[model samples]
Target chain A: MSDRLPGFSTLAVHAGAQPDPTTGARATPIYQTTSFVFNDADHAASLFGLQAFGNIYTRIGNPTNAVLEERVAALEGGTAALAVASGHAAQVVVLQQLLQPGDEFIAARKLYGGSINQFTHAFKSFGWNVVWADPDDIASFERAVTPRTKAIFIESIANPAGSITDIEAISSVARKAGVPLIVDNTLASPYLIRPIDHGADIVVHSLTKFLGGHGNSLGGIIVDAGTFDWSTGGKYPMLSEPRPEYHGIRLQETFGNFAFAIACRVLGLRDLGPALSPFNAFMILTGIETLPLRMQKHCDNARAVAEFLAGHPAVASVSYAGLPSDKYNQLARKYAPKGAGAVFTFSLKGGYDAGVNLVSKLQLFSHLANVGDTRSLVIHPASTTHSQLDDAAKVKSGAGPDVVRLSIGIEDKEDLIADLEQALGA
Target chain B: MNHDAYPDNYIRGILNSVKSIAMVGASPVNVRPSYFAFKYLAQRGYDMIPINPGHVGKELLGKPFVASLRDIGRPVDMIDIFRNSSHIMPVVEEALTLDPLPKVIWMQLGARDDAAAEKAEAAGIKVVMNRCPKIEYGRLSSEISWMGVNSRTLSSKRAPAPTQGMRLSLNRMSVGGGDTAASDRAAKNKSEQS
Candidate 1:
């Protein structure tokens, strides 16, 4: 009644959750059921025909996941969102709606190595060609735009390196090319940078990262900004054309702004069958309640670690945008004013052996392929996550043999600094 | 004024306030979206008037059809435009000519014309674009949740079952919130037993 919109922290806590209707449980209860019972034959028929909204099967939707979807949608300022099994599943589902077989999508060369692999191998086999572009070179995205291009993909903060991308510049290119700009906001999270606010039409996240905060759950979400006109030029037939499965209803015409989320749900997730478990959704939802507090600490701790690494004798350079001397510092200030995020790469003066040795010598930092945990994580990506890529590809993705990627967690800054010092010294 | 997202209260207000609605471009065929919306709203006890040049002499769901807003002969509470975006300006201009202009001008899903919305809003008419009333009604009434749609609203209170007919109310008390009188009583009773 006050006409005041809820603030970020308030929305984070209460956006999509309510006390139980049947029981008074304050926390979101895991429905934990596969299918929901209908009132009668008409209710079942309406749901199947997309004439009504409700839970039919777990593969399509669930109440617990709906709450998570709404919470993320509210946080990102998007019209709707869909939760999936993993970040890779979110990408596959998102692209399935946009790209047909043989259609091409332009992507930033610097990305999560897993994503690069998926785009190159898995997507390629489906006839979805990925045209690589340089995120640092804005014109490269424009150049990669061919008639067959359906979408442009980038990261809000590039993985491993923690570099900032000029989202507005690429958004201009996407607007000109008549394509939606899909930004992977997994690294930055909504607490730091909301991609939708920076001209991203669709924002995807690996909820295993900062959003879940604790890194205890593996989930992914795709938020629909509802900015792109999918019906324009009839380029996106999946939305504009009638969907054969749902009684020939055109999604864009029926659902309007949230049609992309609906298509990803009814078409992609429903068929592909990579639905997030109710328990995982509940775990992630609990994690998100503390997102604002945890994300800030993660940023603060990361800055301290980056500064220490930059001054260390064994370190050649720190790639965190939080450092003033970093190449992406200005862009980071413009886009993520709060902080440059936690995951960043640093190179060792001792080269590949030193990078590998430091990981084993670390006391507190866990040497793992994952990031965005409550505990500090260190990874020699070149030998692990990015090992499949060739030498040039590895270096291009900021996972050079000498580079060490650290996901600084919400720990005592001095303790984190001391651990790095002992490891670098040894 | 941001048509991209409308608060729940704003939409609930429009649906609650409006009684009679004239749906422009309404179709007699059951397959069309306009027909579905018209049928749904009619069943919900609204004064639904269908307006279509092609279906002027026909009846839709036991209601007579008129060719245009001008032929309705009675003032409407709202004008639901189901036409193409390019065709909105003329229909809005016609709505303004009525003795007591409609309280709202609603563009159906995928039908948006910002210029027309602005013009109507300037004349003291509320405008909502690129949305469907049927969806909003089901969403606000928690009827859509029966089918598993994310209404983006949370309520712990169960919606009251229809007493007589298969109709739900837009003016229901449980629009949002988990802590309602019924839910509170249920919680209190459970605690006592436990």
Candidate 2:
């Protein structure tokens, strides 16, 4: 709202939110209705024709969801945002807009196991294909690209292993291929890394995780950097072609910078029908207000835990990039100077039994399939999240039988360590 | 915002009353948009009749495929046209020949014909053009709100549902789907043996 750029915390609190004109409501109230009343006949026509901007229906747009979308877009330095039901839903809609039938997209090999399942299995049903490349080997990404490749997808900070992807290097491959680079910034959030600033054209998030800062709601968002030239080659027809649905108006021509976001909402979300509830939007927005405070503590506590585990005789390995001895320490410093985030993995010398036992024994941590909460969480991924994946996939995702994932929260350092110590029986 | 564009009340009413849908031009191929729409409609508990000529007597989503609207041999509530714009007239003509004519003639995202719409309306049937049923069901039922988007209408009231021993966690975490600790132990033991 001002010429002077406000800090992240301020944007988290104030962006896209103002006092309610009708009721002076300070807190964002959930607009829980199925339909909004029209002022006049002509007004309704304009909204549907895309001639005017307002809430038409919840599936397409809503005022409260608009606030969350704006807050996230501002924080991520994107032109606009479209919030959806889950991280998986965001990915579905993002790819739906980019790829047609039989088209392929290259993805970094190291990623959240659920994402791997989504890309490998569920997406195939939609006729979209995935070609995998190891994040460690940047050249693998280049080799995977073909004329049919429509986009390049990677994570800012990969899940489980806490590895930092070379966003800049992969972005070059995407640019050369004349495709957009999509980065899932769920782990890093905008606090640790802004993928768009480096070279990413689009950023996606599962606000159900850290951005919500609580494990209470499931939500996701797609932020359009508004940088890609959708009209460059006419490859993306959804954005460039005329649409009979909305009176043949090309989305890119009408909604300039954030045309991708518009297409996702109007076409993808409209048909797929994964709309985020306003109640969830309210909760996520509330969680994000204190993101700056929570993220710093999460990093500090995680660094301490990684160090403790690395030295433990019973611990076989610790895989947090925050640790000086970790393989991704330099990348972490370069990409996420503030911290390498709070989710990391470690393996036990006692093996599978020890991994399962540690999760069950931790008092301060809740054993569940979630991360980025105010409360510490732990899970044996092999027996839970990645239980569905095969052994090869488990290893590729950094979720092996001996591995235990830790989502360090904003708890006291000593308390978390005490819980870990008791759990480890050291 | 143009208020006259989407007739919310009209669409909502049709979605509420409609029960069964005969999806014409439905495909068995997973990649086809018709296939996804058919699956989504079926998942939403719609009695789906997939009409694909080549796949007659075959099954899509466990619903036996029919060669045409007349071949359904049952009272069809709605005829969802997934065919191209050029095919709308024949589809509507065939839909009219059903034993009990369908109450609605719905067109998919890009399929629309004013002549067919007029014909259907003259027969006292509702016509929804250039729209999708999968999306309409979500909007009408308020299920789309699960994704964190605002539904726009606000109320302090909530519908009661059956809940027992369920802790209201921050994230809407549900109880286990009957997977017991024994199962995990068995899986782990099998892995260890290998």
Best by TM-score: 1
Candidate 2 deviant stretches above 4 angstroms: B1-194
lDDT (Cα, tens digit) per residue for candidate 1, span A12-74 = 887777666567677888999999888888667756777655679999999898888888887
Candidate 1 chain A least-lDDT 10 residues: A1-10
- Write out fnat for all predictions, comma-separated: 0.17, 0.00
Model 1's CAPRI class is incorrect
Per-residue alpha-carbon lDDT of candidate 2 for residues A1-426, written as tens digits (9 for 90 to 100): 112335677767766665554676777778887777766775576457654345678988777888898778778877578999999999999999999989999999888889988999999998999999999999999999898999999999998788999999999999889899999999999999999888899999999989998889999999888667676678999998887777677776455456688899999888899999989999999999999999999999999988998988899999999988889999999999999999999999999999888887888899988999999999998988888888988998899999999999998989998999999984
Question: Candidate 1 — which residues are off by over 4 angstroms?
Answer: B1-10, B28-31, B39-47, B52-76, B89-102, B112-129, B138-194
Question: TM-score, B chain, candidate 1?
Answer: 0.84
TM-score (C-alpha) between model 2 and the true structure? 0.69
For candidate 1, write residues B29-140 as lDDT tens digits: 5556886788778767789999988876779877888988889888899999998777899999999999889999999876678788899999999998767899888766
lDDT of 2: 0.79
